[model samples]
Target chain A: MSTRSPTPVFLDTLRHVETPEGIELSLRVAGPVARVLAWSMDSLIRYGALWVLLMVLAMLGEGGMGLWLIALFLTEWFYPALFEVYAGGATPGKKALGLKVIHANGTPVDWPGALIRNLLRAVDFLPLLYGFGLVAMLCNRNFQRLGDLAAGTMVIYRDPAAAMPQLPPGRALPPPFPLNTAEQQLLIDFAERSTTLNPERQAELADLLARQTGLYGVAGVERLCAHARWLAGEPT
Target chain B: MPLETIAAELRRRNAWEATDLGMVMVRQWLGSIYAAWFTVALPLFMLLHLVCWGHWWLAPWLMWWLKPLLDRPPLYILSYALFGDPPDRRQFWRALPGLLLRRQAFAALTWRRLDVARSFTLPVTQLEGLAGKVRRQRLRDLSYPSRGAAIWLTVVGLHLEIALDFALIALVWMLTPDFIALEFFDLLDDSSQWGQLWLNVVGFCGLSLVEPFYVAAGFTLYLNRRAWLEAWDLELGFRKMAARLAPAGRVAAGLAMLALGLGLLMIPLENFAAEAPSRSNPPPPAIEESLMNPLCEQRRVREVELAQAGSSIKQALAETLKEPELHVCQVQERWRWRDDNSTESPPRSPPDPRPGQWFAATIELLLWLAVGLFIAVAGWWLWRRTPRAFTRARQRAAQSGPRLVQGRNEITIPPDAGLGDTAWRLWTEGQPREALRLLYQGSLAGLAAQHGLPVRSSATEDDCLRLAVAQLANPELLGFLRRLTRAWQAIAYAHRIPDEADARSLCLEWPRHFAAAGALPA
Candidate 1:
């Protein structure tokens, strides 16, 4: 739906979606690397499950092979799609990786999209080892393969599990300029990342922002830090 | 007054870090790179694909990897645009080869995170021009934040490209209604060789559409990173404030300096008096009192006059030593190899470089970079111009007109065009000016040649009718020619569109009229 314009628009994986209730939600798209890692975890789990079930069913002798084929078909074809559609858009592996499948618009993944995307695994595995699928992912912006394209779906990172960072002891101050969503994000990010930065470097960055605040040198750095604290909603 | 002289050229000189918002940079340059992507790279890719044999997949896959090549163009173009020297279409074409996918083509494909890191790399590689250790340090400093957004850009861009690719294929499929029909669709398998190839081509086209944007977004992220690094927003804000306050600042400075000057002048001479000459000192030795007194220090106590018979003692003291005249000359000499560009010593020539020397060779590193960059540039040159290099094909294209196409349409005009031929040529070329000229010219030529109308080159449509309207008597031709003239005159002079249906209908009638005029075959 977004491809109407011949003028190419920059689409960030970071999607800011508004709910009907007017609450905003930000979602990050998972890249091929993370998705692949999650898929590997899922595959390993499936492999273990197959081994355990086969070992148990071996006691039943001749019937085990026939039953195992049914199990294999079900596990291989339906496992991911079923889990994704039913279990918050994640398979066991995706859950572990803190990833989930969603519609391009940041809505929950629907049954058809999951089924279609999962069904296209065969197509992805063409020639060998998800050959065309890997190419598609590498070539694409969102790291979506052929299936994801057809399905109009995306695999995004579930919001980070980490808690909001604590702003260091400082007098809180409002940012001089009205920050849009991106700027707001930048401030919050600065505060979060500042802990890792050395004092001089932190001060250096803060001083750079001094011009905007009409402050100079140390005062500017302190004020910017205060603004970051305020923006992050930290208690002074 | 400062900016007025070089207003368009004016830009705040900033460090690599002190740039504008990434989005601002991206917005400034988005359109240009987009234009270049489709206008420059797409057709080149298509031509490359056409020339490629058997290995049908090679072009598409190469296109996949070669997109990183485009990342540089946006950076180069953006680098220019940011500094207030945005390249025009022609300039961009000229500059495209040197900067296009210069060195990082293979690395772009091979690295796992290189796709994600491209935006970060643009600044490290291009903007800072940092190399070796310093470059690495800069990259490290820039990597985290840039890499985060870079990942996002890659991911979202990919998804967008995929969606777009799908849409393009769908659009193509929908364009041909017969392809959608059940019987025809069933007959033509999509998995077949040609079918898949066409589909891949469509996919490539779709990918091409979104790739420039992907590069643009990466560029934006990079710009943003640099902005973050340099505090560009603050710097720009400061620059703008300074510019605004400049007139007032100068006045304030002048006033302060004037106040200080006045304050200095108003001080009393007595308060700035010299030390007391007679500090309780009575007359002592002949010259002792004079040395101690301020009044005597500046004043002559006794005057010695020089007589004609005898020279003064001061002159006699100066004549005791002779003054030596000084002379200096700049000495320069050239040896055998002084005029040469070669780096050599004796018969052994240049000494063998040690492994440690290789690492420290900044000059050599730069030289190699240049060579690699040149080769890449040469590749792009060949890519864009290689087809034209074929003399045989150039002649064929001459009859067919410019083979450079925007879309699936291979429309061309004849190189050596005639009246009717020229109009068709112009129409095909999408050149309204030339097309319309030929259209009118062809119509006039038809009127004169077919009918016994006295149409001169200088004659107006009115004059033609007045001279031979009765002789011509064909109202359709007369009406057609008049309408053509009005349309032409409107576009040529007033720059207005005549009634669309009327012009189109006239254009449609052109062939028939030409045939009637015996200007063309029926």
Candidate 2:
């Protein structure tokens, strides 16, 4: 006898859901505050390093007015360039903030993204200091600047831990999945590491349980979700 | 298993694997890279400028430290060739920015021809060379994903853009008769502190002064490139032709985008800056004393006036004696006739003019800052304000209410309201309960409109919420809506949301509560 039954409740509307747009599924992630905290710490470290370097050079140049002038130029220009090229990040500040610059399709940062974002720092620093940049970041999705939009890249917090493992072992199941080894590995890896998935992701996955279990366009996706959760050793 | 099950399983397993320290280390390393970039470049830049200007003392010290920071192998060879020995502490202090980075230092050394030969240390790659490498590395980049070619090109573009603007101004300024006589090269040679500072200031001023012209040209070039790439001109032309033929909305959208871009570009100029500078080396002052040149004579007259204004009788006389006219040594009688004992304290030392000069420079810098900010802000505003074709679901949720509760995954329909879209129509006719489930994802606009709160497509969630709360007597609905808005904003704009029970509760209760509240409102 199944105790779970559909009933009207205030909480019902708040269930994790996926709305089908054309191609890519938009995720509404909730509750992974650790990522945010980590990002902030990372950004601080990076910025701190940058600030240290500047001070050292300033000290080295020993109040040479010319060297100081060059420092100003370097602060605005080559600083970003080095990160863009070598580290594939913004200045240590942006990177430590858990933000990685990526192309629109979630690819590695290209030169355009790096240059645009960095060059746009001039704009961000407009009207005195970082006023425009802050405003732009506040307004845009992924906290992008004009350079980001133009370059088709985003500054996103990436979880290296988010990379999934090879297929989950020891579960007897149906076989017509049409997945290659890499794909299998990717999915399995994703499942094993699922605890790191923010609550919003968990909900989204729960909602999509039907499709992953090959129950999409079939009789019952919700039931499949409950079944899969049980199979995966989660309480259902 | 259902698709949802697979997704959930994958997500669960992924969470378990997120504990990899390696990934964390990579992140930290990437962060370090950012730090290194910020920290290393300024010092490196100072070193580069100093070295180029032949500040050999500091070169060795900078090289010793810089080699470790960089990835390049050739830098060591180059540093060795330039410095003969690595820099020591003594050389480091001697070569600091104050001494090394100045153009005056460069000029002074260049005049003497005693400094080490300068070479471009950062290699200059051809477009083909750069692009070929980028293409080859594309796959690798995708696998590891780092900042690659696009960033370099953009940097080059920035330099080119600024360079082109400067070049144009220089071209224009060079054509003037007065500028032709200006001894720019001599000024460059004078390596004194004041001389170098003055020259740099002048260069900065020049950059600012020619900003308007550069902006116009740069903007035109940018637009032309955009047009060529997007065929926007053709689109506009076609729209114009169509509009002329029938006079409809066919032309409005494209025109709007063009106007929008123009508006964004122009906003910086309009809202922020009046003037900014173009940088260039200043020509040295003329040596020739000939009064034939009007500009030179004007300067001479101005100098005489300033000398008179700045001096007392004795000082005036001293200055006059220095001039070719009025020889005080030869004509001692003229000097003797002057009241030498009348010591009135030199005209109450006119407030040192340095502060005023500094103030003007600050204002100029501020203007540049303003313009830059306006461009960035306006551009961002435009980018975000324009509507995308697809609506984010989170946005809808935010608009509905605060505190979305989990459980309800379907839309619901009110029995009285028959109007529905196609999907709703099908669900209502075939599966009334399913239709009700579908209706769970209520449009905030629909809810507002049904309740008669002057809601429109243009209204923001705050706007709707305010009106709804004010009009409705139920605090429960208001609270729910408020929580929903928070989630919606977080989800739509931030791409994240807070996980609270209220979100699920609001989603579940919205249909019945909204319907009942609308029926019995304040």
Fraction of native contacts (fnat) of each candidate: 0.01, 0.00
State candidate 2's DockQ: 0.01
Off by over 4 Å in 2: A1-65, A89-91, A105-113, A159-171, A175-236, B1-522
Write down the TM-score of model 2's second chain.
0.18
TM-score of 2: 0.22
TM-scores, all models, native as reference:
0.40, 0.22
Q: Evaluated with DockQ, which candidate comes out highest?
A: 1
lDDT of 1 by residue, A1-236 (tens): 01123343333345577888898877555655456657778999999999999998888887987898899999999999999999999999999867899987778898899999999988776534564675576566566789999998988777646786676677788764545454565566556566666667666656555546677756766776688788888665
Q: For model 1, how does the per-residue alpha-carbon lDDT over B1-522 read when each residue is reduced to its tens digit? A: 112211111221111111113333344355775666666566767776787666566777667666666566666665555454556777777767755554444455576334465655766665566566787787788776557656655664576566555555444454566645643343234566576577567667767655654555465556566555654444443344444434455565465555455344334323323433333434335433345543333221111111111657534422321122211111122255556855344463565778669767977899999999999999989877875667655455433322321123333332222445556455556666556665665554455445545444345656755665667677877777777777777777787756656655666677767654332312
Question: What are the per-model DockQ values?
Answer: 0.02, 0.01
Model 2's CAPRI class is: incorrect
- Error of model 1, residue B17, in angstroms: 23
